[model samples]
Target: MARIQTMRVDRMLSSMGYGSRSEVTRMGKAGIITLDAAEIADAARRIAVTPDLPARMKIDGEALDPLTGVVILLNKPLGMTCSHKDSGVLIYTVLPDRWRRRTPVIATVGRLDKQTSGLILLTDDGDLLHRIISPRSRVRKTYRATLARPLAGNETELFASGELMLDGDAKPLAPAELSVVSETEAIISVTEGRYHQVRRMFAAAGNHVTELHRERLGGLSIPDGMASGQWALLEADNIASIFHMDPAKQT
Candidate 1:
């Protein structure tokens, strides 16, 4: 038979942000932790940490939060900072408070500025987070901008030229796509995640962006009926779609 995987019950709970080692021991003594319907009175005891651990364990009459990798898609709201330690209301506050206490910590895959609102991914999986944010991924991020002025007509060519340079940047941006929805609104898609790139691009074109909202990232788009600050805890398979570009989203 293959070797069995296991971990200290207290360590699992504490790492998941349930509590500290001593606190877990107290929880065990209080009959608050259980495995497979049996009371786990010794938090120090090692238990099998399997794919089914979440279903097998209960804490305070609730199933354990997904232990290993947790991913969530949030419709980031305006005026909210993504940093965990940022003062006042933060994007982290919209998620479970216990999530912030997790060992590896849940962090945004890439930042969206405080004034910008749109699709943002947060995950506890370090590798997955890095993969998404890496420039080599070439994942397309689409932003719909409301402009203060009407179309200049040449913006489409300028962005698609693949030679547009933002101030202070040493390299030209990769080819980007621009779609005009109307005289004062346009959608721009880019593979780069440069700082304030979309707004800067508009400024370079001599237009002011009155509002900016990300519509999609790769294949992930904010689902209908989801309000600002709303989020969906994603399944394992759903994570793959983050790397798959949807051709239909180009429209």
Candidate 2:
């Protein structure tokens, strides 16, 4: 069985964006919050936030489900900026108003440039985001890139050897995998997320990236049926897959 995780009432409520810690404390004192049908006056009281526990919690007559953290996978479309501030079309605008208003603020795990498109993960769980994007985790990100010129000889070996250097970098990138799909298009997989890494890597190899589309991240692939600008909730199993582990076996 999965172990139960606990958090203080005020911290949980505030993290979910209900209000500030002091405000939640005040609400608790006013008898607006309850745990398992019993009135809870102490904001610091710890309660289970795990699925393994049966904890019925409510605030002001509304039920709360703390165990199920929000995670979403988006089929990001081109011409959208992955930002809250509008430089071009804001990617967050594509999501429903409720998701945007979520407490703790659901954020994109990693950014895709304005012209890039494909799978993007958004989540309210900070730990999951860090695990997926951290270089130390070595999570694989796969991209299908269209090049301005045909891939030249020895480039694939160079990429696989992790010896290609970008401008202003003293060291070569970690080893990557490359496969040719056509003369001008190929699939590339890397474990790092440097700025314009794909484009710069190609440029350093004497080629230029004309178009780039991310196809996969970690063990999650963009669903073929998902249309551009669409999104779907990532269930617990999907979350587990991000770490390349089985949900039942996850600690």
Candidate 3:
């Protein structure tokens, strides 16, 4: 004999955020839930549950479902916020409408200020996001900064020794690689992520950063061909390389 299964429908709906348990119970009592036009007798009745997309449970004709998750990298353009809320102008607005409709929700793993432009990772993969972002994971991020004034004095040594102070904070920043590629341009690499770190470091060094662009994260370098405001899907090898393991070394 097949084993009988049972659960309160309202409880399941509540768990999924369809409504509060009390509210769902009221909806059922008010003759809202129906399959093929027959009203469900009890909100507590056992019912089979199945996953469906593009279809959802209805409450007085209002449909609802949990957002599905996805991972994406956006070459975030200037003047867009990473947040999901309708923040006037946002990065998601630039994406094709179909991508915006995906479930789970995609978020920019690390953020770039509205005026600071470059590659930004957006994803719903919790484990992968953690691996790429955890401070203990020691993932390195590289940025190309253009300064309003050329760097001079003890800036190079200060950056090399990681002795630059970022203001009221008593402790110094982690060791970082700072090198000048030109008189007015330089590259800064650091593992510790702090609020406005690159710009602040340059400011601390007595050189004001005029423009900031992130060029690399972990082992993945920004593709030379990709331009601002455009994005590409990362391949498996790209994801694997972020952990410092050579993708080619794997069998």
Candidate 4:
């Protein structure tokens, strides 16, 4: 188990989603919180958290375990908005209540529109989340799109040249890779996340995207057997793979 340095009792509890600082203070004063079976009266008392160690806390008479970071890969289904306050069904609805209730609330690394579906990443680690989503990271995302019309002449070269003009912008998008899968289907790879980029790119090319699905991100592909709306925890190797980093090289 990794050992995190000591932190204030209230901060620790609040970080683990136990409650707000004021609420934790109330619990501490009520003697409902214990450290190593001893009543903790000071909310500012510092304590270490080691996951491998035996239970060190009891809240409201129930033994509590130390919290750990988590990463999840969800196979997003159509019609669910990634936003927390969307008018449609929320992506969080697909995850278990336990994860939603945990501290450092799990958040999607990037967004996919409600009409699009496929691999999406979630994590409680803020650093990892920022690394994956940050444009400077230059992580590549691959998508398979179904178009309303057959790919036209020289469009492949146009996309590869990265000079397609998008609305509301004076500059063209960065170069992207495009491959024709069929008359009306194609695969696109890009490192940037522009709003409706794929759809807009096709529109600029005189084509319409009827469907879009993300197939891969960075070095990780959607694992087989993961059905739509299903989710699974990403292990250490999987996390490392997402960033294409060696475990030993991770900060």
Q: Which candidate is the best by lDDT?
A: 1
Show model 2 residue runs off by greater than 4 Å. Answer: 1-68, 245-251
My TM-score estimates for the predictions, one after another, are: 0.95, 0.74, 0.68, 0.77
* Poorest stretch of ten by lDDT in candidate 3: 62-71
Candidate 2, TM-score vs. the true structure?
A: 0.74
Q: Residues 95-151, candidate 3, lDDT per residue (tens digit)?
A: 655355443446678778887887788775777787778898888788889999977
TM-score of 1: 0.95
Over 1-251, each residue of candidate 1 has an lDDT whose tens digit, in order, gives 98878899989889989989999999999999988899999999998888888998899999988877889999999998989787867899997778788988889989999989999999989999999989999988999999999989999999999999988999998989999999999999999999999999999899899999999888888889999989998886678877988667545
Q: Which regions of candidate 3 deviate over 4 angstroms?
A: 1-69, 245-251
| Candidate No. with top TM-score | 1
Please give, for residues 63-153, the per-residue lDDT of candidate 2 as tens digits. 7643336788999999999998768788888876545656767899989998899989988888888888988898888899999998896
Any residue pairs clashing in model 4, and if so which? none
Ranking by TM-score: 1, 4, 2, 3
lDDT of each: 0.90, 0.83, 0.72, 0.82
Global Cα lDDT for candidate 3:
0.72
Give one digit per residue, the lDDT tens place, for model 4 in 64-159. Answer: 743657788999999999976778799998875545666778889989998889989988889899989898888778899999998896767887
